[model samples]
Target: MLGFFKRDKNKIAKDGEDHTVDSMDLLGEKAETTGKEVKTKLHFPPNVEIGQEERYYYQFLNNELPLLKENQISLSGIEVHSAEDGTVSVKAFLRNSLPKGVRIAEPITLLLLGPDEDVLARQEFNLTGLGELPAESSTPWVYVFNAKNVRVKEIPQTDWKLAFELKKAKGPHTLDLEESWEKSLADTDKEKLEQLVKTIKPPKPGEVNFMGIQSRLDDAGALHVTLLIRNGSEKNVKLEQLPLNVEDASGEVVAKGAFKMEALEIKANTSKPWTFIFPKELVLKEDADLSKWKAYVPQG
Candidate 1:
């Protein structure tokens, strides 16, 4: 047999916690006398598993008539006026007894259906403790929104359908948080290793004014090379003080030379130029070529 509408047995018990109020037992209309106060009490079913040690956000939605004149709502927490046995006093005036299984600290949302099946008002509320006391001097557990602000509008006497909904929030991510901490330490270690390696490196070779071999042969096989060097340092770095080297694809030094400059201040973001040419004997079309060669600019 297939069931058209099936309910989760676990969720059924949870839903029972939100709908503890009985409308018939509560007041049908506003109180007549000013300064007159009424007390309402609610209870939960036995053997229900409602948590109490944590805070939960809640709102009370009234869709039938305007619960509040304006949209302003606030719920602090339920105050205990008095308590004994398994009953407690709530300041809200109700015309009926509340439904069983209403536990404290659970998030609850109220939905009131408007005319033509429209949703009039939707609000959330949270309960925070067990209502198992009947003491008259006690207060209801704190509700987040202002109950006085919630009221029915003065339209006309019409029946409104109401229901409640509930949901929970997801917990924090712990695994990713741990990985972030490890990655941070790894970056710091890499930086330290770079500094240590640079400290023991040899100083660059002295600079030469102009080191290049101008070939008279234009055999397409002749080495045609151009090098533009920049001294990216704050101090004045002369070509005579630069330890420069050029290596081809075979790790062979195609040209290693230095140069001289007019004691130029290699101010930050500035650089000089260097041009080098290889001998025709070391230059080749396949086995030897400057195209695969490279220049290394050591960091000071």
Candidate 2:
């Protein structure tokens, strides 16, 4: 299913070797604890192959299946403690069940949320620092939070939810283009697409900017928004799904939804347009004045 990373085995082998050294440095520099430390362990199953074509469908089955029966990422044996100087220490065991070839390129965003679902503190933990794991092997991770860094008023005793967001490192496209889209393009366009894929570079965070946003009502009274996004980054960006929020003048979120990009891929240093149609039923407020609302991509 993932064919992009295999294009150049020799190059990947070299990269893999370099990854080991990078992992060591990353682990040592990040996720170090200061106060009292605790230990724990977690076990995970192997990555499952369900033969599903759609990504979301696979994700649904992955989440709903029993932990023992499913090949999945698992976390357990979490321990947290606070020192007298207000430093907080956290430790947890993690097991990765993702395909053996896949490697984490970025630190996973860890969010501690309050009772009202507000984020109390956000931190990033680097799993790549531990290097690649053999399918079901376990790895322990530690995180230290200084009192001056986090926004939490006090150490959380209970009633907190930990959320994790993982982003893979920039690599070749794993999946092929949709058959319908490929068939629609001319031979020359197809060649250009392939060439772009080979030469495109990765953009920095916040490099993608919005040029314009316009909203309209469809015949069925659905809200459709047209957005012009400029790719200011050095590499192409795949925009299959984009999570965004629209807030009012007072900073209250009036509407939120993920927009599916029809074009799918945005070439580096170029501008592309995407249209999102929100069903009337999904509108959070009936009289939401979207005209003056500000739109932005929310950080995880």
Candidate 3:
């Protein structure tokens, strides 16, 4: 009887060891399968070639040039008169051809460059003091410079060009008005705007959380995006006009637009779904991979 009990106990131990080994094998197989699935689902976007000059030009076009073109604002009658006493008086007329409704919030920067394109002196002229630029009107801006304060061997007597740029003000919740004015934007302007928008990733509001992003090609060969947004705020929030930019894995802007949601309001601590359909023309690259694209929301 003692031998029989001992043999039964040994049999039970063997069975237990076999079961444990089988279970480990099954788990290992599952882990390997899951890894393969994840690898298959991952996608990468194509690489793009962009030079530094092209990048800077794109930024200028998007940030400063848009408003000037849209409002038909021009710098004319520029006169630079210098005296023997090292005093330079620069005068220019800013003409606005478009009707009123736009405000130039920042100062217009004028750079006096030498023949070799080296900046000799710089000046900023504020337009906000004059209030909104009226239609078919002209405003005079005068900048006086003392030669001692200038940073050049000598101011160019001839063959000089006045370079104009807008100085951007930095602060929280600052929105680029030029970007918002897209009614008269050209294709090239739109492209530059898309690129500029990609670089501006404002801090997401504490109450908002982006959950996931998915995309698929529709029947018309257009890409459709499904975004999961969660509102963690105590009060309900609206996402009807949420501006978003879609970027590839390489961090290039692929497409950008405001998202429209059927259910605009999201309850507190709840998630909502938003869909966007992008046409082929909206894509920046001809052979862009939608699988690796992500949507980014710019916060105010």
Q: What TM-score fits each model?
A: 0.21, 0.34, 0.30
Give the best candidate by lDDT: 2
**lDDT, candidate 1, 1-300, per-residue tens:** 011123233321111112223222121222222332333323222344433421111111111111221111112111111222222122221112222222234455654433444544456654444343232112223222233323433211133334343332322211111233345546665454334323432223332122222212246434445433332332334443444455576777655444354453332323223334445554433344444666554345
Against the true structure, what is every candidate's RMSD? Answer: 27.2, 21.5, 36.3
lDDT of 1 at 23: 21
Q: How does model 1 fare in lDDT? A: 0.32
Candidate 2: stretches off by over 4 Å: 1-69, 84-86, 98-102, 115-117, 146-149, 166-205, 208-300
lDDT of candidate 3 over 6-120, digit per residue (tens): 1222221111000011111211111111111100110111232444653443233223321332224454323455667776655444444443433566565666666677777
Best TM-score goes to which candidate? Answer: 2
In candidate 2, how many Å is residue 163 off?
A: 2.3
Query: What is candidate 1's TM-score against the reference?
Result: 0.21
lDDT, candidates in the order shown: 0.32, 0.49, 0.48
For model 1, state the Cα shift of residue 273 in Å. Answer: 3.2
Flag clash pairs in model 3.
none
